[model samples]
Target: MSEQAGSPLEDLTAGGPAIDAFELLANETRLAILVTLWESYRPFAEDTTLQFSELRERVGTADSGQFNYHLDRLTDHFVDATDDGYRLSDAGLTVVRSVIAGTGIEERTLEPTTVDMDCKLCGSPAEIAYEDGWVYVFCTECDGLWTDRSDDERGQLARFSLHPAALADRTPEEIYAAAWLTTYQKLHSMIEGVCPTCSGPIERSVVVCEDHEDDGICGNCGRNGRGAARLSCAVCKEWVQSTLGSIAKYHPAVVGFCYRHGLELQYGVESLAQIERRLDEATSKVDLVSETPPRVDVTTEMDGDEIRVRLAEDLTVLEVSERTA
Candidate 1:
C-alpha cells in the first residue's frame, strides 16, 4: 500500500529527530515551573502568563541563569513563551493535572465500610474501600464477584479507578458514588470505540471461558460470568475488561426498557443507589447461549417483558429479541 498524500505520517517525519519528552523533565526546576504556571493560569484573566522574574520568585529559585537554562529546555515542548511572559503549554498542563489527579504521587488507603447498596452476587450489604487509587467493593457473605485464584479466602465484587482528590471531605458513600460515575463514563466511552486514556481509537472483542464453572466466582475461569468484553487502545495500549452484561446497560434497548419501568439509567451522589438497584433489577439474567463461536445473551426485563441482546463472538449485536410474557 502507498502512503496517502498529506497524511498525518508527514507530520511525524517533519520533525528533524525523535525527541524524548521525558528526558527534558528530569530537573526539579522544570517541574516547579510547570506547576507554578498551572497555578497562576486563570482563564478569564487578561494576563494569565507570569513574567520571568515573577515566576522565578514563585518557584523560589535565586539563580536567574540556572532557572533560565531549565526553562529554555522546556520552552517549545512543555512551556509557551510569549513576549509578555510564559505560560504552560498543553503538555505542561497535562503533567501538572496528572499530578493533581494523584498519579504516582502518593499511596492512600481507606478502611472497609458498609455502603448503602447490597452486593449483586450475594444479597449481603456490600462493603466499600479505597486502596492505591482504586475503589473496591466486597460482599460480607458470598465469594463476591471475583476471587483471586491463588487465594480463595479474599475476593472483591468490583473495583474501579478513582483519584485520591475525590477522597477529601467525603463520606464512604460519596466516594463510592464518584468511582461508580467515573467507571460508567469511561466504560461508555470505550464501548463507543474511544480510548479513555489518550482519546485514540479502541479495538474491542469478546472472550469466552471454554471450561467455565460458576459457583459464585467460577473457580475454573476466575470470572463470575462465562463471557467478557476486552477493549484495547490501538494508540496507548490501555486495556479494559468487563463482563458483557455490564456494558449492556448502555444499549439503547436496555435504557428504553428501564425507563418504561419507571427507572432511569443515570447516576449522581443522590441517585447512585437507585441506579445501582435499577440496573441490577433490569439486567437480572445473563446466559451463554453458545461457546463454540462465543455467543452470549444479556437479558433485561421489565413488567414481565424481556429484551435479549444477543452478542456475537466479537461482541457485535447479532440480534435483539423481545419476548412478551
Candidate 2:
C-alpha cells in the first residue's frame, strides 16, 4: 500500500499506474517527490528541476533506497522525461486533471470509512467485491464491477456491462444521463395528462367542450363549461377544449376507431398506430401543467365606443358583443 499525505500532499498519491491519475499518495516521501516535481514545472515559484540527490535534501528522508522506490513509482506514472529530467506522461497529465476534479480513486482504496457491503447483484460478500479490485464499486446485480460508473448507468444505451452484457460498456456520464432521463420520464408521466385547471389526471376523462369542439376538453373544465364542444387536436394529437381561437387554427383528422387513423404518411392508416405514440410517450410529451382556465365570456354593454373585456390565462383577449337592442 502507498503512503498518503494529509494536506496538499494528496496529489502525490496514486492507485495502480492504470487505475488513478494519482493513487500512490499515502507516503510522505513519495508525496514530497511528486510535489518537488510539481514545483519544478510550476509557472512561477522558481521553476527549477532538481536531481534525486537534491530531491533527497528537499524531502529530507533518511532512507536512500526508500526514496528511490518512491521516485520510481512516480516515474511509472509518466512516460515522458523532460529535456532536463523526469516529467509526466500524457496519461500522467490526465491523472493531474482527474486529481483536480477529485475523481481519481485507487483500486480497493480504503476511504475514511470502511464499510463492508454485500454484493448487491450476486449476493456475494465484500471479499469478491474487491477480489478483482476495481476502481468502480459496483455489484454485478447490485452494481457491476465497473471502474467509475454504476451498472444502471450503462443500461440505457447498450453500454451496460452485466455479467451477460459485458459487451454493453458505458461511460459514467452516459450511465448517469440514462438514469436521469429515466427518472425524468417517470416524473413527466406522473404529471402528464393531468388537468392543469383541476389537478386531475389527463387520460381518464373524455368530456368534450362546445366552444372548441375540435380539441378535446378537460372533463373538469368541460363539465363546468358544459355548453362548450370538445375534441382532440388534429396536428399534435392532444385533447383540448374547443376555443374560438383554437377552432380557427385547429386541424382535425377523422377520429379513427381502434387506433386506425393518424397523420398522412407512407402507409397512412397503417402507420398511424406507430404514430399514436403509446400512452406513456404521449404523457411524457406533456408540458409543465397549469390548470386550464374555464373560458368565461364576460359581456359588458359598451357605449358603442369601447367594450370592457376580461383577460385571463396570459396574452388572451376575447371580445363579447354588447347588447344591440
Candidate 3:
C-alpha cells in the first residue's frame, strides 16, 4: 500500500532513533536526577518547578558540571528545561515511577503461614510466604511453587506491591490468586465507566485468539492458555488481560457456587478432570454482553437451583438472581 499524505505512519517512522531514549537513561546520574525531580514534584504540586541549586542540593551532588551534564542529557526527553529551573517531563515521571516500582522499594520477608489447600501431588498442606514483595504458595511435600522458576521476579513483585492493602491478612495462596482476580476485576471496572486504579475512563475489548496463537502457555504460572479479556485505562494507560474463568472467580455468584459445591477455585482445581466435569455440569452459560461497554453474565444451575449473575464491563457484580428450578 502507498503511504498517504500526512499519515500517522510518517510521525511514527520520523523518530531520530529508538535507542537514543535508552541511551539517555543508561547513566546513573541522569536516572537519579529524574527520581529526585519526581519525588520533589509529585502528589501535591507536580507542576511546581525547582531552581537548579535547589534540585542539585536535593540530589546531594557537589559538582555542578557533572550534574548539569546529566540534566542536559534528559532535556526534551525526560526532563523539561524552563526559566524557573527544572521539572520532570511527562515521560520523565513515567521513567522515575517505573524505576521506583521496579527497584526503589526495600525487600523483606513476611510471616509465613499454612493455607487451607493441599498439594495435588502429595496431598500435604500448602505453605504460603511473602518475600521481596512477591507472594509464594508452595507445597513442602512436593517442593512445588505456584510460579515458574524462570519468571521475571521484578515485574511480579512490582505488580503485587502496587496495591499493598490487598495483601493484608491474606495467605500467600489467597494473595496470589486475589492479585490476578482483583486486577482483573479492576480492569473490568475501568471498562464499565469506573477505574479502580485512577478513577479514569477505561476501554476494553475481546482479544482475537489468533493474535495470541504463539502464547500457548503462561510463562509465569505455567497455565496452558491465555485470557480473553483485554482492558486499557484511557488516562493511566494501565492494561490487563486474563481468562474469563480466572476473572469470574471473584463474582458473587461464582463464590456462592464454589461454597455450595465445596469446590476451591485455585490453581490445581482446573487441572483435575473430575473438578472440570463438576464445573461444566454446574455452569449453564457464560454469556458476554454485546454492547459498547460490554458485560459478562454467567449462569449456573444445579439440582433444581439456579443463579444468574450480571457483571459490569469491569466485572463488578451489577445484578445477581437466585431461583429454584
Candidate 4:
C-alpha cells in the first residue's frame, strides 16, 4: 500500500533484474553463511578446498540447529553436500568471488577491494570496482560488464547448447550430437567413480521426470533455478547466459540434460575457475571442430558431467540397466 523513498533494502532490490539471484543471500543468516566462504579461503588455502565441517565451525552460531538451517538454506542457495563435505556451488562461488571483490549485496559489509586486474569482460585494466555487490568487469570493445556477482564460465556453458558456436558449421542433427556428447561427459564426472548406492558400473546422465514438483516437469534435476544464479558467458564473459546451450537446451549449461519429454542441460560445476580454463582451451580451437558432427557419448567433460571416463552421455546408463565390472 505504501513505499519509502530511501529504504536501504529498497536500493538493494533496485536491481530488480537480478532480484532472483540475490534473493537467496538476502536473508541475514544466509548472508552470514556466504561470508563463511571467505573464511574458508584464508585458513585452508593450502587445503585448496572448502569443507562443510569447517564452514560449520567458522560460522559457529549459538544454535547448532539454527546454524544448520541457515547452512541448508545457503546450501540450496549456492552449495551442495557431498561425501567430501559441503562444496561451493557454481553460484556459491560467484557469490563468494563477488564478496572477495567487494561487490554483491553483501560486499558493503566487508572491507573495500584492494586487488586489481584487467576487467575480465572488457579487457581494460582497472582496480577497485564494485556495484550491486558484484565485482564488475567492463569491456572496452562492447562496454560489456560481467559482474563479480556472476561467473562468466558458468554463463557460457549454460548457453553453449544452442550457441551458434556450439552447433557451428554443422547441421542441427550434428549439433544435437555435440550437445548429447557434452551431456554425457558431465554426468560421468558426478557419479563419483561409481554409483553411491550401487557398486555396478554407474554413469552420470540426464533423465526426464514428469513427477517433479516444479515447473513443467523440468528438463533435469537442479536446473529449475537457472534464472537465480545466471552468470556471463565463460569465454566472452560479455553476454548474460547467451551461449548456445541456453538458447537450444532451454536451460543453463551447468544444469542441462536430455528429456524426451523435455530437454535438459545440467552443466553446473564445482569451480568456475576450473571450468573456465577448460572451456577456454576448447572454444579457442573449436573453429574447425564445430564443423564436425559430434560423436561419442561423453568426451567434453564440461558438456554435462564432471570428469570420470570422459563419458559422452550418462543416459547410456539407462540402456545398460546394469553396472559394469
Candidate 5:
C-alpha cells in the first residue's frame, strides 16, 4: 500500500499534499460524480455500483471524452473502479456528505426574533437568530453576540425557538435551568468522547474557575460559580464547561448508573440529591494528601464494574479505569 493509504489522518496532515486533493475536487463534473456514487451507496445495501454509462447519464455531460478525463482525476483518491462499476471511496463519501450538509446550512434561512433578556451591559432588548448553522443571541444595544452551535440541526432550531414565553408558566430560575439542561446535553455528548461541532475527539479536564475567589464565577459565561469542569475538542479546540456538580454527569460511570436506574440526569430536587449522594460516596473512597492543588485518589464500584479515578484540584477526572473482575 502507498503511504497515503497507510493512515486516514495522512490525507489531511501537514506532511501530506492536501492542496492536490482539494484541487482535484475543484471541478463540477468531479463533484457530481462523487455525489452520484454516494447516493447509490444506500444504507443497508450490499452493492453500491453504477455502470460507467449510468454514471455518465446521471452527471448529464454530453462528451464522453471529457467525462472520462474528469472521472480519471478522482479515480485513485476519491473514486474506485471495479469489475462491476464505480463507487465512491471512503474519503469521497466524507467530502461529499460534508459538502451537502454545508450547502444545506448555507441555503437555509432563519427568521430572527427578539428574546426576553435585557443586555447586561446596556439593559436593552436582545435578539436570537440562526445563521450558517449556529444559533446566536445578540444584544442590539451593546452589540454583544453569544453564539452556540448545537450537536444536531434539529437542536439548533429548538434552541432558537426557546423563547422565555415558550415556557411562560415557568419561573425565571426554571427557565435558566431549562436552558442549562440543553447546554448540558450537548456537553454530555462532547465529553462522552465525541465533539458535537466537528465529530472530533474531546479532552476533559478540571480547572479552577477564574472567579473561584469570587465564589466560582465562570470566566467563559461570567456566571458566578465555584469551579468548572472543562471539556475541549482535541481537533477543533471548541471548549465547553459547567459547574463541578453539573460536569460530574459527563462521567461515563455516572452516565451508566443513571441509565441503569431509569433516572434522567437533570437538575431537580431528587436528581441533585441522588447525584450528590453518589458523589459523596465516591469521595469517601478517596484519600487526600494535598490541599493547595487538591488531588484525590478514589474508587467506585457500580453495576458489576469497578472504577478508579484520580481527580485534580479542580475536580477534573485526570485518569480513570474500569475493571470487570
Candidate 6:
C-alpha cells in the first residue's frame, strides 16, 4: 500500500521490490501480529493503532526482543509502523480477511439432497450439494444444464464458488440461492467489462464451436452449447467463462421478455431455478453468426414471442430484435 497513485495496469506490469511476500509471512509470530491488528481494527475511528506492549500481550509472546524482530519483519508490507503504534496495511487486511473467510481451510461437506425445485430440462427432481468450496445443482433425470461437467456425470445444472461461512444459519436451499446470486452478480460485472474480484478492467472473447451439436451433450464440441464468453482480468488474473445466454441474462430486452412470461429473476431458490431453466432453454438456439469478427446471437423464446440478443466481437450487446413465432 504505497502512497503513490499507480494505475491498475502499472500495478500488474511494473517491477517492484524483490521481497518474497510468501516468505515474509511464513513465521508464526508474524501471522499472529497480523491477526491481532485485524482484531483491533476500527474503520471509522480516528485512532485504531495498537501499542507495541498491547499487541505483544494479546499475542502472548513474552520475549521483547523476539517480538520486536517479528514486528520489524512485517513493517511497510503487511503492517505499518506509525509514530503512535502499529496498524495493518492494506495487504495485511486482505490476508486476515481471506484467512477468516476459510479460503484454505476445509470446513465441511454436504451430501447431495433433493431440492424443493424440479429440473427445468426433464421436470425431474433436482439435487443440491456442497463439497470442496463449490455448490453444485443437477437434475436427477435428463441432462440438467450440461452433461459432462461432473465427475459422477450427473446432469450438471450449475456449479459456482462458495465459501464455508455460507453454511452457517442457513439450509441447503438457501445456500444454493446465495451462491447463485453471487455468481449472477459476478457474471453481470464480467459482461460489463469489469472484474468481479478486483474491480479491474476485463477483456472478453467468444469461443465458437466449429461443428456444433446440441442434443443434451454435444458430440462435436463436447460442451452443451455452441459458444461461450470467456473473460479475464489482466490486473488480478480473475477468469470467468459462461454460455452466451448467461452473459445476456441481464439485458433489458431479455428481462422484459422474462417479465412478460411470468419469470422473475429474483433472489430465492425458486427464482434461481427459473433463471437456470431460462438459460438451459436459451442455449438451444445460440447461433454463431460470424467467426471472423466473432459475433453470437442468442435467442430466447416463450409464449410465442421470440427475442434475439446479438453480441458483437467484444461481447457487448450489439442489437435486440423481437418477432412472433
The candidate that wins on TM-score is 1
Candidate 6 lowest-lDDT run of ten: 264-273
Tens digit of per-residue lDDT, candidate 1, span 133-204? 878887888777665435335468888888888787779988888887787777888988889878999888
Error of 2 at 276 (Å): 38
Q: Name the runs in model 6 displaced over 4 angstroms.
A: 1-19, 42-47, 104-106, 147-150, 256-284
Least lDDT summed over 10 consecutive residues: which range in candidate 1? Answer: 11-20
Model 4 CA lDDT for position 230: 23
Candidate 3 per-residue lDDT over residues 121-152, each given as its tens digit: 45676555666645555565543322354553
Q: Which ten residues in a row have the lowest lDDT in candidate 5?
A: 152-161
Considering lDDT, which of the candidate structures 1 and 4 is the better prediction for this target?
A: 1
lDDT per residue (tens digit) for residues 182-247 in model 6: 777787888788897778999988888777776767776666777888888978887766778777
Clash pairs of candidate 6? none
Clashes of each: 0, 47, 3, 51, 3, 0
lDDT of 5 at 12: 54
lDDT of 5 by residue, 1-325 (tens): 4565557656556444566888898899998899889878986688888999999999999999999999999998999899999998878887877676556523543355565445443566655554544444555654232224434221111232232232435443344344445566667777577887678988876554332334232337443433346678888686675445445445676566555645445445223244334433332133443445765555555555555666776456777666765
For model 4, state the Cα shift of residue 306 in Å.
48
* Candidate 5 displacement at residue 229 in angstroms: 3.8
Comparing 2 and 6 on TM-score, the stronger one: 6
Per-residue alpha-carbon lDDT of candidate 4 for residues 263-321, written as tens digits (9 for 90 to 100)? 22334332333333333322210011111221122222233333111112222221111
Model 4 / residue 289 / CA error / Å:
35
List the global CA lDDT of all models: 0.79, 0.36, 0.60, 0.38, 0.59, 0.79
Sorted by lDDT (best first), the order is: 1, 6, 3, 5, 4, 2
